[model samples]
Target: MASSTITPASLPPAGQTSNFVDPPYIGGKFVAVNCIFLPLAVIALGVRTWTRLFVVRSFRWDDYLMIIALLLSCVLTGVTLEMLNWGLGKHMWDVPLADFMAQFPKLNLIAAIIYCAATGFTKVSVLVFYLRIFPSRNFHIAVWTIVFIAAGYSIASILANIFSCNPIAKSWDLTITTGSCMNRPVFYFANAGLGIFTDFATVAVPIPWLRRLQMPARQKVAVGVILAMGCFVGIVSCIRLGSLYTLLKSTDLTWATTDALMWCTIELNLGIFGGCVTAIRPFVRRYFPRLLGLSSGGGYTSSQSRSRKHGHPLGSIPHSDRVNFTNQDNQYTTTLTTLRGAPDNGSEEHILASHPSGHAKDADGTTGIIRTVEFDVENSSTAPQRE
Candidate 1:
């Protein structure tokens, strides 16, 4: 429900194409839906905290910043809507207690400023985060450049938010007595252009550089897909810009503003999603345990591994040719069932079945006890040894 005080003011005079715009929209679905997704995003973030703990993790800082920005933006939007709800009750409820907020005036645009700040701040934060994660010199310059441009534009937007209405309250849930905002379309257009371009820079900055990395075709595709995932958010940004126009042009803006808010919220939230997805190597392993294979990177202390093995369901792990056993303290041991680089025949099995005393510790921490599981990459898994 809208405020009674805001009803006549929220609308443009009949037969006129012009309208008095509220800085931030209230009593719309935009605020409601965004409130719901915020928590889920934060929860997704919490579950991924494990990656940060592993000493050999490959996570990045931008991942954390992106998550934080999403949460902050979500909360700020929620708070702004709550404020609108307060206004609605004050102006329309039977015995509302929020008249103080309604009467204080100037709060609409202030709320608008808060929402705008959250919007811009979230975008810029995500941009810097993307820049941080990618590997390129241009990525650095691009992040800083966009930081100055987008952040500076937000300041301009805040100024516009402040001066849009003469008495300020006029900028928010308007009344018939209120003075209308200044050149709303032009203001929106400038800000919209700045915002759209900033999103483009943010979304595009990493593509060229990522394209140049000398990786395997499969790995390059994986990286490309990850970086390109941001384009989905870019689409949302474009839609949000359209919504900005719908919001500016419509007087009865429940639908337009809701649509606009939804798109913008999605754009920002998707960015958060992108950030979190980048860190999903560990998360996917945690949530979908089967797909990731329950292994601790096999660096667990000997004692921890034993306890874990005892606690873990039997056969949950297939029997490897070799098994590692760790005792209390720093002692490590491996029992290998088969030797590597062996002949492709049963003879290889017999060689391991009746092996000689080839006792030796290689630099990679493997000894005669046998390292059954081998990740054949350059950084191969260490063979097991007797303590």
Candidate 2:
């Protein structure tokens, strides 16, 4: 084997050097974190795909976006593990300078770009999910705004990282010192700051709507917590910020950034986890119905699946109900009535049926199911009688 070309001057600065012979190889921690989280995220994604593709049977844009996020995350994981071979988690001075110069900067650059894209896609996937469920125009606008901001930040961050050094190749080549590079510390700080903002935005946007749901308070909180899993990723991002600052400021690049890199890997995996979790309600509702307070055969069924099996359009009355109304007057009156005076279970959907004059209208007509009724009046002067 050829001898390494590393020189004494090429080593990390004396201030960053340690005297310990086997200075802690923290690569195991990084590896362990990735080993644990990536598989969990992948499992979550797998369950999500099963839920959306087979159980819920309503695969859509958000699902596709999450798939992309997971793919990028896998790539990022591979890159990080590869960087470990080049002394990523050891003290800088402990590493052969030739090895450090050969690969670390280049791999770090690729990881940054991958992280941005992965996280962005994950957030947008969750936002698109909001678009699917919430018909509120204001909520849609808010979701779209966050989507654009996340996407734009990803694009901008990727561009900034790619062109951090003027001559592009200068990013990996420390020997070429003539080229101008962006203030990377400042750029990173800004990127992390904006990313945290979007994280909070994603976690907060659906809260108001969730609180307004008619479900019990406990279930609502559970749902909110599940959907807001990204907040934990945000919290991880916050913690990663400190590590990032340490790496940016320290002379010990390899050792100082290990924790930050680990957190970065974790953040992306958790983003994948969060993006896939909320959609797994169908899976839980199917296999573990008790968790959702539903019976063995009963849980959430998408309108599409219902339509396919029952042959009725979404929001339209079924054939069985249609037969009962054929003999009534052509004039039909539609009114919204509450579930009050009726049995109230923990069901998620409420059906409103039209009735005679005494029934009150719902405050929000768009919510719940609406049933139309036809009235036949035998005598105009008398009070209406039930058929």
lDDT values for all models: 0.53, 0.74
Q: What is the TM-score (0 to 1) of candidate 1? A: 0.57
Superposed Cα RMSD, model 2 = 9.8
| Residue 156, model 2: Cα distance from true site in angstroms | 0.1
* lDDT tens readout by residue for model 2, 1-387: 112444421354545554234656889999899999999999999999988766665679999999999999999999999998876888776777777888998998898889888988998998998897788999999999999999999999999999999798898888888879997766877898898999989998988887676765555666867756877888999998888888778877788778888988888888888888877776776678677566665523322232221122222223344433334333222323234323222124545545555453333332333332223322344434659
Q: Give TM per candidate.
A: 0.57, 0.75
Q: Candidate 1's residue-wise lDDT over 150-255, tens digit each?
A: 7898888888878887766565544546566687656765676777787667767767776666654554555556567667766767777787786677644333
How many pairs in model 1 have backbone atoms within 3 A of each other, for residues 3 or more apart or on separate chains, i.e. clashes? 5
Question: Residue 2 of model 1: what lDDT?
Answer: 32
Model 1 weakest lDDT span, ten residues long: 341-350
True-vs-predicted CA distance for residue 145, candidate 2, Å? 0.7
Q: What is the lDDT of residue 255 in candidate 2?
A: 82
